[model samples]
Target: MSAATATKTAIPPSGGGLSRESHPLAGTGTLLRFNLRRDRVRLPVWIGALFLGTLSTLSSTVSQYPEAEDRRSAAGSLDSPAGLAMTGPGHYLDDYNYGSMLSHQMLGFMAVLVGLMSVLIVARHTRTEEETGRAELVRATVVGRHAHLTAALVTAALANLALGLLIAVGVGGQGTEGVNWGGSLLYGAVHTMAGLVFAAVAAITVQISQYARGASGMALAVIGVAYALRAAGDVGNGVLSWLSPIGWAQRTYPYVDDRWWPVLLGLALAAVATVVAYRLSTLRDVGGSLRATRLGSPVASAALTRPIGFALRLHRGMLAGFGAGLLLMGVMYGSILGDAEEMIEDVDELREAVEKIGGATIAESFASTVMIVIAVVAAVYVVMATLRPQSEETAGRAEPLLATGLSRTCWVASHLAVAMGGGVAILFLTGLGFGISGAVATGDGGLFLDLLIAPLAYAPALWVTAGITVTLFGWLPRITAVAWIVPVYAFLVGYLGQILDFPDWLNNLSPFGHVAKLPAEAMEWTPALILTALAAALVALGLAGFRRRDLETK
Candidate 1:
């Protein structure tokens, strides 16, 4: 070939059809089988957990308030300050049916979990392989650049499809006569579509980021923004909801409006996102991005000179983000509290229930409820932030830092400080914000004082998560995944206990289960102090382990 022609010639997409002989492309089918084999246990567990949890929740809700009036009373309680604070907008409570409540409380979480699964799986398949050098060997053969991405998405599609079917069966089997099967499928479809769209989104983000963490952060940021937009739209004017993918899914109003059309919209959006990802992939080189990373300092700064400083530097951004989010959530919930009493009038029986639950003014009940929710959400943040160190250790980044003059204790403590301190600050900020707003709307400045006490109630729970993280890092580094299991199990048990009729022993396992739902009820110091002590002991155990163990070899 002429030099000019040779310069312009491109490699065939799959090594010119010698896929297996020349590239991993030929092994796609084999990889598919292998991937399924590898995921057999993990996939089943994840899918089953989601399905069973959802089913249990649905069944419980249906059972708890069988009468329409009872449902209305439950809704009324939600319209209280505590209720609005804990849950989102109060309108969903008006329906007092299984479907509406599930949609309100469960739908967003479902989307988020599904979306996260999609992003993590797809990014692991594509970017993780590239980062670990596995993709290069596969690519050297005849594998298409897009092969891993496609496989990852194919896997997510299968997972989501099964998840959707499970949800349909779970909800439909409840024997709620005239239960909208179509709506259940619509809910599942929207969640599945969200997963697919985000899988594509993660693929595109991985191409743009140099590190898996960066890619994961990008995808998570998208999820956060989408959720925020939806919340803003749902609570406020709702014009902004149109901009969020999550909003589109929720607006499907699966059980309420049972709108089937929006599911199509979500699918269409996912298709477009996939196409865009493919086009973007064509423009980037393997393991590189169109966006370049900026150069670092020529010399190590004071912060970089120590592990604690490094941990702080790495985690501060996320901590700050969580703090801001908490504040805004507080403000939104507080602002809505003023309207709670008014909204409750739509259902007199529900209003009566609110009075019974709080046995006082509706405002008081709501304020108390809001505080509990703030604590719950802040606790979640605590777990996530505390566990950051484990992620670093597992990823091998902690090794270099440990080699540098950092002690194991200091290294672990830095992350713990961020998690515990950040959780306190975030929850406090939320309470403060909500109190201020509630006071303004209700013409009761004392509302601020009342709200202030709420987040403090959560401190013990937050600390527990921090200490658990530390303990896991020291003693069970490989199984630190269990750290999250604590929070997840606690959350499910506490929230679903009344609904699912679980045995007390099962419920007692969650440390958080002991936390008094504060503000709604008077503060109970015993549980709080106990949790705090337990957390401290756990941290000590973790520190002891850390002192004996070798720095992560990685």
Candidate 2:
């Protein structure tokens, strides 16, 4: 035989066939490099977002509370159960400085963000590629059995390390007297470890579920439950906190205790989760999951005959999850209104800041500010729902339906209807939760009606965001992922513009910035009506463009 052919046919000394010891992770290095190249844009965006979020909180806290006394007063206000529940633990309250307060405000949120990033990245590389049949092609080459999973984990690890370094540099560079470099390092380390724990969880979940969406759903549910456990523990007894990864991260109290033991717990959990994932991986086939997918109905229902009904069936799970989450957030925010009022009353600087931001009253300002934040979050869902058609088309599912009697407009309109209707339903539910909870806390029956009507003011702004996504999906299907940047920009501008003292025109770029701050100011029909008209125009333009465009598929 030719030398090259003979060499290619050669087997290992121990066996003719490849075994676990010989080839389990044979191509891990190559896969790791490939995975890095694939995620170059994605990793940078995740790291930048986490770093910027941390830095902004630090700068804002320093600027808002320059004096030690102001810091202490603010910390004291947050020591209450309501505040603890809204934020994480109040252990940082004991240290009472800019860094500590900033950590208290940002750590839990940052941890969650990193956790989500890790989970999505890992799942995207593992289950998603496998489901799409890309991993099968790669495995048919010289790749090892564990190479894909190992590469995904390594990539996630490297990304987490980068995030940690960024946090450390950003926190240390603040140069405030309150900045403790050791504590800053600890803060970054805890978040990094939190990411690792969730990455492992996602790996294990992907092994358990056949579909990428199911795996991601399971991981996100774990995160949601972890947050809930931590909140309960912080507001009540501290025992429950030990059960949650987030609670473990928060208990580190970076600037206060600077404890490193909880980090060990995170590391141990990650190790255990990784081992479990590997074991499960060995037990399952390449295209199969550890758990069997449940069987669906053999016969289609009458509702499945229509486009809208099929779209609703596809999106019902996502809509339910989003709706429940918004409702829970509304309840939490509403419960804290009384404490917020007390804090504003006790802190003169805070009161001035609120008034400067156009808060007619402290309560009105707090509620309106929260409404704006919720509206921004709702806009994210709007984009996701609107872009569902693009995802469907790229997945090749839309081609089959289009080959039938289904018109392209009908198909696209079905998804848009869900987007618009679902957005309205979620907003209304959030408002209802907030109003009910606020009424219960304050013993004011009138608040139930007032807050209920306030969220509706921002509905037009939400629709505008959806309309933009639809336009992009129609005209720029190849780069429709760029639509995600709109909500991110809107969030930064709407939430942080006034705090960062950005120019009016810069803030005006966000549609939410144009909506009247409800309850704090009178509802202006002119702006709302104008925004609605603009949204309708955008949707019409998008539909026209879509009609003439060729279908783009993967």
Candidate 3:
């Protein structure tokens, strides 16, 4: 039979009901291999970054504080509100060892990122395929129900294990005396287990939702809850923190107590979760969700008719939530700014670090700068939200809409407008909140102007991220993740390099680095305008490319 005919004949039901005689492994092994091949480049990038992060931490720690007293001062800085809120509770930083210092300052973020990578990989491989109907086609051809699911977990597990081992080598290579190789191993173990725990959670979410977006949301919610519970536990009562996966990993106390038991506990929970996920997968139909989305209004709302209106409809909720979050962050960071000045007065090294980021400045200015950094992060969400239209089009959802009466430009522009415009508004509000509160605390109304200006300084970088997404969405649609991933890499370079004492070239990649450090440094319009123009040009190029390309096939 011809390949086209064979492909057509091979598919059983579009909805993916399988026959009893179908072999689970029939098409699965090959698909797994194909997936591995596809992920070869992406996997290496992620794993390499994770290991590099660990190595950077070790090297930077040893270099930054060669003296014992310096290490103590640095450790003491952790008790301050700015440190604890930005990093985490610093209970473990008393030790001068490279491992303990890094574990206290950096490991939580590592664990969070590793888990994030694992969850994204698994969600994309499994739930996404089902959502797109590809899984149904594969499942109809003697592929076992468990094959795709199994492959996702296996792939995530393998990637995470490799990441852990690389981290182990990275930490050991630091050449620190009295280095606890065993403790380092346990450190890697704890992070790897955290990845596994989230991987299992993602698997379970995929089975429950059978859709990528929903699964991603579920996984992120888990991360958010874990962070919140852990933060509360770390700050207030220890009881709530134990409820969070992040707390469990942190409580492992990698360098101080050097406990391996918490990691095993993570493993135990992961195992149970995996088994349950497998059972659910067996019982559920492909592309079927356990929880149903409530039906929308039978008739379209009046506001849904216009492209901009429709875009606003889709993004309004998230924008509101982000705005609220920024306000909350403003209050948290602003309130802590006063406390930070008091707490860090005795710590020279800590003071130096802060001064480097933002010079000897009023606490309100420092708070405004910090809030702006966070607003930079929120810009990423804005870009992702804006790119949704492009993603939908590339995934074939836009095809039918276009086939009807919808124009491609209008639809795409709508999402972009929401992403760009909404981002600025939210950021402005965040700055307002942060600036106003900090000014009130310092009894200086001038702080409000600084706060407002800080977010404006960051606007160019935010638009650049969004513009890149839009540009990519039009051309090379298949690799559109590049738009988001590149900015993220730039962020890593800037943020982590500052922490790890990386070279100047590394920090310069992000436009954020070039933007005037508001309230901390004098404002410069040259770089800001340049970044804004670049971002606008990128969006124009993307739009031009998108207009020329044929509608993507599902």
Candidate 4:
């Protein structure tokens, strides 16, 4: 052999050999450790929220129903399809106690929270990293092909495990009379399994979509569908419940039957999903997805020539998804209104509680409560939409758009307009859905008009939330993520304040707390007008700040 040829043959290629590449899971531990470090703040926040929320629910249940008679009365009132639909199956209703009551009230919400946590974590590590080109930089090192995916999965699994342990500890600390360690562990385990199942689903979804946004949307869509299915199943027959992870968790009956079988189903499905994700990961190139992206138009339409149109185009899909989910939820709540009214009439205690909460009648109170909850949920979309400008700036897209004669004011306003308009659309659709379903169910066509106007009462409150997000985005761009804490805090105050006996002042910190319970009570104009003025002021302040500050870029 030639000397040059021999020298070249003696040296190994920098990219490594096929044998080395074949072991795609190598270096997963190192990547997992890195991921844990990165997620330290995020994971703890999620776990802490779950822990505190669970503890609050447990303590509230015990305090609210201390006596046996009270417990029995509460359980009897919630035994109907409407109650079961709002809660879960209420498997422990027959032999009810504080622990079971807490479980029925908190399990579904906890499961959903954990599911959301898992989906975001998985998508952040997988598709987001790839989309941002960070994964390529990592892969250029000594990392294995599957190290990124493996690390994401392991991190999510560990997070779920930690959350489960926290929940168990929190439940045990509640020290309810009938609460047992086994039941506490079971409750935590069910939530952990539900989180794992969704994590696996997110893993598989990230593989299917090239873009991080697409992956996130797809995973959240699955969560919405699963929740809707569980709601339908709980309100009707028990068959459809078996198809959802949340349903599976609830069916475990932690404080009652303590069934272990449903957990196996979640585990089995997660395993299959993980295997499928790994297989699919091998089939696609980095930044490529199993689902093909559609080609865009070569020519721009007249609408696309404007900033508002462009903003609307970008936000339309997400707004559509949020609107649809809200509509479905509203319909679900409306469908149960008649049943809720009958149950309230039959149970004097429930009627008293409902009246105390500003319900003129059981139906109106129930509908008003549903509207408030839906409004808060829809406000989440407003926050997200408001933060879109920040996301665009960080992604390096805004700089180019600005270079093309687009002023910062116009650009920011475009996104804000979409956020405000989309928020109103979601609120309206939610009210319309409720109104239509309620009118049909109650045989009162006039119900439609009342319900339609109800959600509008909360619009000013939602605008305040959007304004806060915008203000944060403009002034404190780097820490804009802290804006999410606002909605979470609002949820805690608005939903759990009375149950936790929080002071009125603390509850009033949430804009939703300022909103008058409408349709049940006469609409108060003072708070609404004040909130509107505040929202307007905040938006103006944000615009002024954005105009003065340097544009943030990644």
lDDT of 2: 0.84
Model 2: what TM-score? 0.93
What is the alpha-carbon lDDT of model 4 when measured against the actual structure?
Answer: 0.83
Q: Give lDDT tens digits, candidate 1, residues 380-450.
A: 77877887776677667778877777777888888888788888888778888888988887887876887
Q: Give the lDDT ranking, best first.
A: 2, 4, 3, 1
Give TM-scores for every candidate, taking all chains together and pairing residue i with residue i.
Answer: 0.82, 0.93, 0.87, 0.93
* Residue pairs clashing, model 4: none
Candidate 3 pairs with clashing backbones = 24-144
Query: Model 2, poorest ten-residue lDDT window?
Result: 345-354
lDDT of 1: 0.73
Cα error, residue 475 of model 2, in Å, equals 1.5
Provide backbone clash counts, one per model. Answer: 14, 0, 1, 0
lDDT of each: 0.73, 0.84, 0.75, 0.83
RMSD of 4: 2.9
lDDT tens digits, residue span 472-514, model 2: 8788776777878777887777666654556779768778888
